[model samples]
Structures are given as C-alpha cells and as structure tokens.
Target: MEKTWNNKAWFMVLPVLLLVAFSAVIPLMTVVNYSVQDTFGNNQFFWAGTEWFTEMLTSERFHSALGRNLFFSFIILLIEIPLGIVIALNMPRKGWGVPVCLVLMALPLLIPWNVVGTIWQVFGRVDIGLLGHTLERLGINYNYVQNPMHAWFTVIIMDVWHWTSLVVLLCYAGLVSIPDAFYQAAKIDGASRWAVFRYIQLPKMNRVLLIAVLLRFMDSFMIYTEPFVVTGGGPGNSTTFLSIDLVKMAVGQFDLGPAAAMSLIYFLIILLMSWVFYTVMTNYDAER
Candidate 1:
C-alpha cells in the first residue's frame, strides 16, 4: 500500500517561518554587511574585504575578552551544576512544601536582568549597603570598586544568586518526573541513598541536565547587562568579557567595523560550541 503524506501542515508554519526571517535573518544579514565594509558618514560604505575580521583575530584585547568569557562560563558551570543537583535533591518532593519551595526558587528568575545588576551594584557598596557594611564591621577589607578580585567575587555571587534558581528548578523537575516505582525497586534492592542517586536519579535527569548545561553556558558566555551595571568592565579591564568588549567597540569607541566583525565571530563561536555540546551529550546518552 502506498502512503500519501499530508504536506498541508507546512502552510500553517509558513507564517512563523516568515516572522523568524524578518526578525532574525534580516538583522543578521545587516551585521554581515557591516562586518566587511567601512563607512564614515552620509550613509556610505566601502568594501574592506576581511580586514576587520583579520584585525580582530590578531588583537590582544579580543584575546583577553575571549579568555574572560570562557573562564566565567567554566566557573559558572562548575558551581551551578552540582549545587543545583544538591539543592534539588534536598528540596521537599511532596505536600504543600513543594509549591512554597518552587515559588521561592522562581523568585530570583522573575527579576529583570538590569534590575538584578542594579540591586547588586548598590548592595556591594561599602558604606550604605548591608552586605558591604556587615563585611566592613567584621573587619573584612572588601571593595569591589577598587579591587579586581572583589569585583570578580561580587559578580560571581550575584550571578549564582540570580541564576542558580533556574538550574535548581530544572534539576528538581527532572527528579520529580521519575516514577515512585524506581524508588520502591531501589529500596527492595536495599540500595543506599548515594547508590540510588548515582544510578536512578542521575541517569533519569541526564536529558534535562544537558539542557541546563547548554542554557547556562550560552547565557554566561553572552552575559552583559548585570556585569556592565555592576563593574562597567572597570578596574583596568579585569572583568571585561566578549559582549562588553563588543559594546565598547561599537558604541563606546564607535568602531562599528571591528565590532561587527567581532559580533560575527562571537556568533560563530556560540553556534559551534552549542553544536559540539549537543552532539557530545546525545552520543553519551545513547551509549549509556
């Protein structure tokens, strides 16, 4: 028997496809155009080939920013993944406590990005802020404004406070989705808590864990507003990441050509890394 496939469903999705092309594709093409060209004024552009790209590739400033971005992402993943898992495991899995815990976890995620930055910016001030004042009273020499290490610490803690909730929620959802029968079987086998988590929970959470990792990695890599508000990439470029550097080039210095080129490179790096992450995780899941 010959089976006829219904192709009409594509028509329903055509509107969404057009919306994406308009919002995403057109802007990307514009960036690609600027990346290869130079313009001074009067809506004029001159082709400079790949000169901007080559310059960015050779620039030490770009290298430093890229290094900062990679390091921050690595630190975030290291801190968040296991911490999220632990918090999720400890959270109440049943009764009214479940909803209360979930709401609290979600509160941080509800705040706007800029708002989070602003909150941390003032909160870390030494004189008037509770955290800074408490630290000072405790004889701690903490000053994010002048000290690079303190700046890094403040930014990291702020991010953890804001985004760890997301990871916790993801892991918690994964944990709760497992059937009670799994726990019953583990109990029948007289499995220890560690063994149950190591085998049943971890394997069950693998798919959501992959999603959480990818999401966190990409967001951390492209982080901008919060750090910008808090540090302004200050204290001598100590905390400047790729997104901040790109903004400095494009808007701060008006170096649109190099900025556009850098933006394209940044986009490619993210695309490539995300593909690599997806491929590796899916392969590992398949093997397991």
Candidate 2:
C-alpha cells in the first residue's frame, strides 16, 4: 500500500511563515529599497543605481572595519573553542558537582547583552572599577579609554567571558550523551585517558563543536552592544568593528543610503561565511 503525504502540517506552519515574512522579509525589502536609491528630507527618494554600493565597497572605512571584524572573530573562535572543550572535559559527569558546574557554566550566558556591557563598563573603570583599579595599583597603565590596544584587549576579554560558556555547554551536552558502554569498552581495552578522549569524547563532540564554533563566529562578527557600551568604539576607532561602524554611518551620520547598502553587504558576508562553515563541517561529518 502506498502512504499518503501529509498536507495539513503545512497549514500549521503557515502562521510561522507569515510571521517571518512580516518580521524579516518586509524589513529586508525596505533595506534593499534604500540601498539602491538616494533619499533626501521630506520623504523624497531618487534612483541612484549602485552608487552607494560602489562607494561603500571602495571606502577605506569599510575596509578597516571589515578587517577589524574578521580579526576579532578569528581570535574569539581560536580562544573560545579550545577553552570550552577543555572546561567541558574537566566538568564532573555525575554527582552533586554536575549541577554546580552546569550552573556556573550557564551564568554568563544568562546575562542580557546590554547588561553584560554595562557591567563590564563599570567593572573596567580605572578609578572605580575593580579590574582597572587593581591594574593601576600594580603600576600598569591600563586605560581602555586612552589606549587603543588596551581597549581591544578589554573588549576581547569581555567577549570571551560572556560567550565561552555557550561553547562549554554545547560541548558538555555532546560529551554527556556518550553511552557508558563505550567507556566500559575503552576501559576493558585498557585505553589510556588521553586515548579515550582522543578517540571517543572528541569524535562524539565534533558535531556540537562545529555548532559552537559557528555560533561564536557569527555572534562575534556582529558584536555591537557590549563593545559599544564598554569602549564606545573609542581610541580612534581601534576597536570599531563593522557593526559599530555601520551604526555610526546609519544613525550617527544619518547616511541611510550608504548605511543600508553596507548593512546588506554585511548581511551577505555573514550569510556566505556561515554557509561555508556549515557546508565544510557537514561534509566533514559525512566523510567521517
């Protein structure tokens, strides 16, 4: 007997589709309209073809912001992935310690993005902040407002603190899902601790690791709130990544045409990079 296909499920999903179109699709179309056209006061718009796109692509500001975004994202992935894996591996697999470890790992991820930025902003002030005051006492010239390198360092560290927990949680979930039978077999075979982790835990965690890496990369690339609050893209734009620069162009300078074009380009870049990451990792999973 042939099975009948289900058509009713799509009706269940129709509301969600309409919601997405309303929320995402409509706004995106508005941005596209702005991107290809020029606007003046009084709601007047004129066709500018690709002028804004061309100008954005050729601008030195765009290049600098893009480079900063790439660099910050790369560094975040590098530090967070390994650090998370190590923390996950060390976490207790059972007993009372498990809940404690899990809660600790989750605390950073629970904070709102803007609140995290606010907390850090206050926490890093030279006179009032614990971290900055301690550094000052140690005779370290650690001023995020005055020094570009210090500003970058503080922002990177803040991000690592806030988001590394996500990677840890993902990896921990992957680790915990491994059956006890596998560990029993490894034990029976007299596998070393290193060998067990290398062959068993690492392989099991690969899928989650890929997910963690991609999430961190995308979030870090588009980071705005925390960095904005902490550094305000200060010290001559040293820590101003693409998101910050885009906001400055759009809101601060009121250059809607260029800003819209830049935003679309930024969105495309993120989409393309994420697709590449997903494809490569998925292919690797398939191969293995």
Candidate 3:
C-alpha cells in the first residue's frame, strides 16, 4: 500500500518564512537597491551600477579596517581556543565544584553586550577606574583614550573577558560528553595525561573546538559595540574593525550608497571566510 503525505506541515512553516522575509529579506533587498544607485536628495536616484563597490574595493580605509578585523580575529582564536580547552580540561568532572565552576563560567556570558562595553569603558579610565588607577600608581603609562596600543590592549582584554567563557562552556560540554570507557581504556593502555589528551580527549572535542573557533572568529571579526564604546574607533582609528567602519560610513557620514555596498561586501567576506573555516575543520575531522 502506498502512503499519503500530509501537506499541512508547510502551512505551519509559512509564518516563520513570512517573518524571515519581513525581517531579513526585505532589508537586504533595500540594501541591494541602494548599492547600485546614487541619490542627490528629493528621492531622486540615478543608476550608478558598481561604482560604489569599485570605490570601496580601492579604498585604503577599507583595507585598513579589514586588516584590523583579520588581526583581531586571529588574536582571539589564538588565545581563546587553547585557553578554553585548558580551562575545560582542568574543571571538575564531578561533585559540587562542577556547578560552582559552571555558574562562574556562565556569569560573563550572561551580561548584555552593551552593558559589557560600558563596564569596560569605565573600567579602563585613568582617574577613577580601579585598573587604570592601579596601573598609573604602578607607573605604567596606560591610557586607552590616548594611546593606540593601550586601546587595542583594552579591547582585546575586554573581549577575552566577555566571550572566553563561551569557548570554555563549549569545550566543557565536549569534555563531559566523553564516555568513561575511553578513559578506562586509555588508563589500561598506560597512557600519560598528555597522551590521553592528545589521543582521546582532543579527538572527541574536535567538533566543539570547531564550533568555538568559528563562533569566536565571526564574533571577533564583526566586533563593534564593546570596542566602539571603549575606544570610539580612535585614538586614531587603531581599533576600527570592519563593522565599526561600516557604521561610521552609514550612520556617521550618511553615505548610504557606499555604506550599502560596503555592507554587502562585508556580508560576503564573512560568509566566505566562515565557509572556508567550516570546510577546513570538517575535512580535518573526516581525515582523523
């Protein structure tokens, strides 16, 4: 006997599709429309084709911002991935310590992004802020508002403080999911701690590590709020990543055409890079 399929399930999905169209698709189409046109006010728009895209591609400002984004993401991945793994490895696998450690790890992640930015912004101030005041008393010339290097340091540190917990949590979940049988087998084989980690634990955590890397990479690359609140893209545009630059163009300068084009390029770059990361990591997993 042949079975009949119910078509009503698609009806249940229709509302979600409509919501996505209204929220994401329509705005994207508007950006596309703005990207290929020029306006001189009074709703007058002229066809400019790829003029904005070409200009953005050739701009030194764009290159600088892109470089900053790449460098920041690289630093975040380098620091957070290994740091998170180490923390996860050392965390208690059982007992009362587990909940305490988990809760502490989750506290930072619970803070709102804007609030985190605000907290760091004040925390790095030279006069009243504890960190800045202590550094000053210690005769370390630290001021995020004036020194580009200090601003970069503050942003990087703030980001690590705020987001590293996510990596820790992911790694911990991966670690906890590993069966005790694997540990037992490793122990029977007289595996050292390093050997167990290298041969057993690391392999098991491969998928979560990939997730952590991709999430951290994308977040760091598109970072805006925390750094913006902390540095305002200055002490000399030193911390001006792509998202900040795009906002400066769109909202600060009101160059809608160029902003729209840059945004599209920004979107594509992120999409391509994420795809590359996923492909590389998945292939490695498959090989292993």
Candidate 4:
C-alpha cells in the first residue's frame, strides 16, 4: 500500500516560517550588510570588504574578551555538571518529595535574568546589602563594586544558583526514564553504588547531559544581561566578556562595522565550539 502525504501541513507551518524570516533571517542579513560596509552617517555606505573582520580578529581587546568568555564557559561546565549530577543522584526518584523538589528546582529557572542580576547587585552592596553587610560585620572584606575578583566570584555564584537547577532537572529526567529492572539487576549482582553509577547511570544519562551542557554553554557564552546589570562589565573591565565588549562597541561607541564584524565572529565561534563539543561527546558516548 502506498501512503498519502499531507501537503496541507506546509500551510500550517507557513506562519512560523515567515516569523523566523522576519525575526532572525532579516536581522542577520542586516548585520552581514553592516559588517562588510562602512557608513559615514546619513545612511551612506561604502564597501569596506573584510577590513573590520581583519581588525576584529587581530585586536587585543577582542582577544581578551574572547579569552574571558572561554574561561567563564569552562568554569560553568566544570562546576554545574558535577553538582547537578550529585543533586540528581540524591533526589527522591518517586515520592511526595518529587514534585516539591521539582518545583524548587524550577523556581530559579523561572526568575527573569535581569531580576536575578538586580537581586544580586542589591544583595552584594557593602553599605546596605545583606551579604555585603554580613561580610563586613565579620571583618571580612567583600566589595563587588570596586573589586574585580569579588565581581567575578559573585557572577559565578549567581550563575550557579540560577542555572544549576536546569542541569539537575535534565539529569533527573534522564535518571527517572531509566528502567527499574536495570537497578534490580545491579542490586542482584551486588554492584557497588560507585560501580552502578559509573557503568550504568552515567551512560544512561549521557544524552541528556549532552543537551544540558550545550544549552548551558550557549547561554553562558551569550550572557550579557546579568553580568551587565550586576557588574556593569566591570570592576574596571575585568568582567567584560565578549557580549559586553560587543555591546560597548556597538551601542556605547556606535562603531557599527567593527561591532557587526565582532558579532559575526562571536556567532561563528559559538557554532564551531558547539559543533566540536557535540562531536566529541557523541563519539565518546558511542564508544561506550
């Protein structure tokens, strides 16, 4: 028997296609146009052809921001992945506690990124903020506004608090989807907790772990609002990652061509790195 294809489904997707074209494709083309052209105000354009791209690639400031972005992403993955796995392992797999735990995990994820930043900004002020006041009262020096290290630390902790829950939820879902029979077999085999986790649980969670890492990496790489709100890209440029630098170039200085070039490079780097991560992880998983 031959199957009939429903061509009407294309009509249903037409609106979504148009939306994407307007929202994403059009804006991307605008950036590409800006990147390769020079404008001396009044809607005038001159073909510059790779001048901005070459400058961006060789610029020390751009390199520094890119390094900071890479370092931040690495730290985030290192901390969140292990911490999430531990939390997922300890969570009640099936009980009244399950919904409670899930709700709590989801709460931080629900908060707006800017609100999280504002909350931290207020919470870390030495004069009036609870955290700052307590640290000062304890005779410990803690000031995010003037201290670069403090700003970086506060940002990292805030990110962990806000985003770790996503990893936990993803890992927990992977854990729960696992068959009870697998656990039964392990128990019967007298498998140690460590062995069971290493040989079975970790392997089972691999796919979801991949998803969580990619999501977190992309989000962290493109991070702007929280750090911008909290640190304002500083304790004097120390916390300025690629996103912040891009904003400063584009809006702060209105250097359209350089900023546009930087944005394209920024996007390509994320795409390349994410592809590398996916390939390495999937291949490693397959080997196992």
Query: Largest lDDT belongs to which candidate?
Result: 4
- Ranked by lDDT from best down, the candidates are 4, 2, 1, 3
Where is model 3 more than 4 Å wrong at Cα?
Answer: 1-14, 281-288
The residue pairs that clash in candidate 3, if any, are none
CA-only RMSD, every prediction? 3.0, 3.1, 2.4, 3.1
Q: Which number leads on TM-score?
A: 3
Among all windows of ten consecutive residues in candidate 4, which has the lowest summed lDDT? 277-286
- Residue 259 displacement (Å), model 4: 0.3
lDDT of each: 0.94, 0.94, 0.92, 0.94
How close to the true structure is residue 58 of candidate 2, measured as C-alpha lDDT?
99
What is the per-residue lDDT of model 1 for residues 100-158, given as tens digits with 9 covering 90 to 100? 99999999999999999999999999988888888999999999988999999989999
Q: Model 2: how far is 249 from its true place, Å?
A: 0.6
Candidate 3's residue-wise lDDT over 100-153, tens digit each? 999999999999888999999889888889889889999999999999999989
Residue pairs with clashing backbones, model 2: none
lDDT of 4 at 260: 99
Stretches of candidate 2 off by over 4 Å are 1-17, 187-190
Model 1 CA deviation exceeding 4 Å by range:
1-18, 284-288
TM-scores for every predicted model: 0.91, 0.91, 0.93, 0.90
Candidate 4 lDDT tens digits, 175-284: 99889999999999999999999988998898899899999999999999999999999988899999999999999999999999999999999889889988988798
Residue 79, candidate 4: C-alpha displacement in angstroms: 0.7
